[model samples]
Target: MSGPFDGLKVLELGRFIAVPVCGQLLAEGGADVIKVEDLDGDQTRHNGPIMPFEGRQYFNKNRGKRSISVRITEPEVLAAIQKLAAAADIVLANFRPGMSESLGLDYESVRAMNPRVIYGENTAYGLEGPMAPLAGMDMALQALTGLAHMTETGPEPLVNPIIDYAAAMLMAWGVSTALYHRERTGHGQRLNVALMHAAMFLENNQLTHVELLDSWRGEFVRYLKHAFADGKTWADVIEHRETLLPHKVVRAYYGFHATKDGTVGVACNARTQRLKLMSLLGIDDRWTSEPGWMPEDAHAHADYVYRQVATAFAQQPTAHWIAALEERGLPIAPVRHSDQLFFDEQVKANNFLAEVEHEVLGPIKVVAPPLRMTETPLAPRPPVSLGKNTREILAEAGLGAGQIDGLFARGAVREVHETLEDLL
Candidate 1:
């Protein structure tokens, strides 16, 4: 059976992660996704932990989509792109606020041509905010949304651009929902997903504030502000914040422990599981059972238990701990590097990775399509080269061969015939 979105057409005017990924997800669902790139291509195409012409970052996000390179500033090129947008069922863009409007590819412009188009827009911040016009990136959004401060080992942002990916998921979900709405009402709507909003989505549980129950929140903020203004170091600020915050009694049960061979994560949430773990390590569970636990006493007992557990865990290898924890029905997992994933038995069993041969990079494994459907399973497609479909896309847009040749001659469009040398 064909995938659910087999006949859908998607036009992606996106750079970097969010929009490209949204388009990718749609393409995985069997949409015909065309990624429009500037003459220089997406910035990520040159970003490297791999070949400069097609970096891993670009490879991972732009899969399953055809690419067309054009200089949108040229009126003819703009008109050609508009033709694609007009025919698109869904239009995705991640340009900063007003950037789309300037390019005449905004929701208003596309909606005028195709009323049934679901236009998905991604930004660093929301469009109406004072910071909307200012450029935003994943790390900046993480810092702005307190994720940086929430890190245990000082104010460090995650190496991965999680917010960008999260925003992409939101746009994909929002666009899918809009498609359903259009199916029902015969009308399309615009959807906006901001990285700041995605940060909030991630921290929703942590961001809850009830004046009666969370009065310390205000005091903590004030204390943090005063501490920062006084030029206090992050360690100093963290120390003060810990004193103000409520005791995290179960924190010990939900943390990584360094074993003899490697790290292992343990998550023993239930009382019985904690008791079992304590018994296995030959540590006292008296503090957990006893009543009238004073703050100082509880802290001392917890510290002792934690240290004992740590010492015991360190005595064994990660594999040993994993087996022991599994035998006891406790939750535990050995920490493995990303490189190990391709060879992992569990990953292979689940078919989580798919191998494809790239024209330039040769055979490689990539993350498989995320969802699984028994009837209409998602299929992984090989990566397309930059400007690989430029000529075909222009032809599809109703431009004749002569027009295409002229566009190429004027440097208004480009095509990658067979190799990265085409771009160079």
Candidate 2:
């Protein structure tokens, strides 16, 4: 099937994760995404945790998009970019405050050129906030939004940058909404996405913990200390341990009995499930009978189920446990590492990976867009090298050969590779 955005044109004047990821999603949806890079390319091009074929994080995030290496500070290059923007259906930028207007690529300028252009801006913070000018990265935003503190169980808090990825997803959703609105209204709109705001929104429930429960702060601290002391990591502590109080029943629920082999995670929060688990394990029902299980006892109950399941699972290999759980109609999944995800049978069955031939890297595997539309399946496209499509895109913009050469000579347009050495 053809893609949903077959005829749409998008000009992405963004860098790093959030905005570039949004553009990647649009490209996967079949938009003609032109990524505007500087002479040195996006900083993500140098980011590590590299794939076997992709240069760095950059190639992974930028697949299915063309690149235009232009020095936007230069008038000629800036003018050329503006011309491209004028012809684009969407313009995405993640610049600091005033940077877009200074470069003459803001929504106002693009709107003047094309009333139907949808402009999207992503920032570290909201445009009007006191911290508007503060630079934002996933780590910084995590700290600013209190996510770091909320997740922390130790004296010193820890932060994870996965929050940035979530923010990018949110930005993509917002942009898609704006595009849908434009389709109906026949007028474009400006969209703003801030990493800080996104992080806070993601922590909605945690933020309201104090407001919703009386004496929640003291209880929370005590829970935190106990969960941490129990040897759980921050994520584990916050989720399964600290969130619930410790009591006899709770201890029974959360406790895990280790067997000779692997471990299994089990939850028996519901009365029926707990009874079923107890019956299956041949455990005494008196555990639940004494002192009706209070809300604080939930943790203990979970621990009890966890221990039983762990012991049972330890008697068999992971595959055996999986089959046994399925046979019993129990909800269970073996934990998997990120690298193992690609090899998952379901992932392969769903065509979650796409193979592309690269000039330097030869055949490379890229993760396919996660969004699935039965009627309009996404098509994989190779990422362009720096300014690889400069001449072609400019030609589409109606620039003659002589004009193109003039711009090339003037450094208004750069080539992807000037020499074989560049391929390396």
Candidate 3:
């Protein structure tokens, strides 16, 4: 069977992660994706550890796509881009807020060229807000959306670019939905996905605050404002916030515990699991087991339970706890570093990784397509280097050999064929 997007064509004007990842998703579904880049290529090409120009980050997200390198500032190059846009079924871009308008690839311009084109856009903030014009990356969005503040060692940003990945998923979903809507009614619409919005979506459960039921939320906000006004440190604010947790579940039931050898995560949320864990730990705290029995000193009782669990777990090795928890059918796992997954039996059995040959790096492993389909399975494709497919794409766009050479002569377009040392 053919893939879902076998005959679709996508034009991607993106750098870094979010929109590039969205384009990758469409390509995995068997769309023909053409990525437009400037002379230096995507920033990630220079950011990773493997090479001076083409690196791991670039390989991960730009796979299964063709690259067309051009200086869009030149009129001839802009015209060529317009021609490509006119022929595209979908156009994706994650340029800064006003950069697209300047380049004439904004939704309005692209719509004028191809009204039925599904346009997917990513921005740091939504289009119609005070912060719309401002530039933001993953860390900034995390701070703006309270993700940083909510972490355990909080008021600090997470090292991972989770917000970018979330935005990419949202963009791909929106584009797929748009494709469906177009199939039904022959209409195309623009999709705007913001990193801030994605961050909020990631915290949906915590962000849902009903005014009547969550009255404490407003009071907490007021307290934060007061704390800011009083020049209190972030540590002080977090310390104050800790005292106001609504669900005062005994701390022993959740989080990581250090065993004799390594750390293991334990989550016993259900009553039965909690009881089983308590029995194994040899504890009979009436405050936790008895229904509707509130401890007089809640903090003191919680501290005691937590210490007991911690001490008991630390007495044994991580493997011991893993075996014990699995036998009991409780939710538990040993803390394993990310590198371990590359050699993990379960990951290999599931085909979570695929090997692709790189011109410079030889064979390397990368994450496989996240989804699977019974009929139309995705095959891995190696990513091309900067401007690697420029000539072929221009030929497909109906540019003659002489015209393409002229563009190359004028420094408007380029096809890079370089050695590793030359790239460096």
* lDDT scores in order: 0.84, 0.72, 0.86
* Candidate 3 lDDT, 287-307, residue by residue in tens: 668988887767778888899
Give the per-residue lDDT digits (tens) of candidate 2, residues 287-378. Answer: 55454535445555556655665555567676665575566666556655668877889989988887886666567777878777889877
- Give the runs in model 1 whose Cα sits over 4 Å from its true position: 49-52, 149-153, 285-287, 290-301, 418-424
By lDDT: ranked, best first: 3, 1, 2
Which residue pairs clash in candidate 1? Answer: none
Q: 294, model 1: CA deviation in Å?
A: 5.2
Per-residue lDDT value at 108 in model 2: 91
Report the CA-based lDDT of candidate 2 relative to the real structure.
Answer: 0.72
- The order of the candidates by TM-score, greatest first, is 3, 1, 2
lDDT of 1 by residue, 82-195 (tens): 999999999999876777889889999999999999999988888886888888999998888987645545677788888999999889999989989989999999999988
Query: What residue pairs are clashing in model 3?
Result: none
TM-score of 3: 0.94
Backbone clashes under 3 angstroms, per model: 0, 20, 0
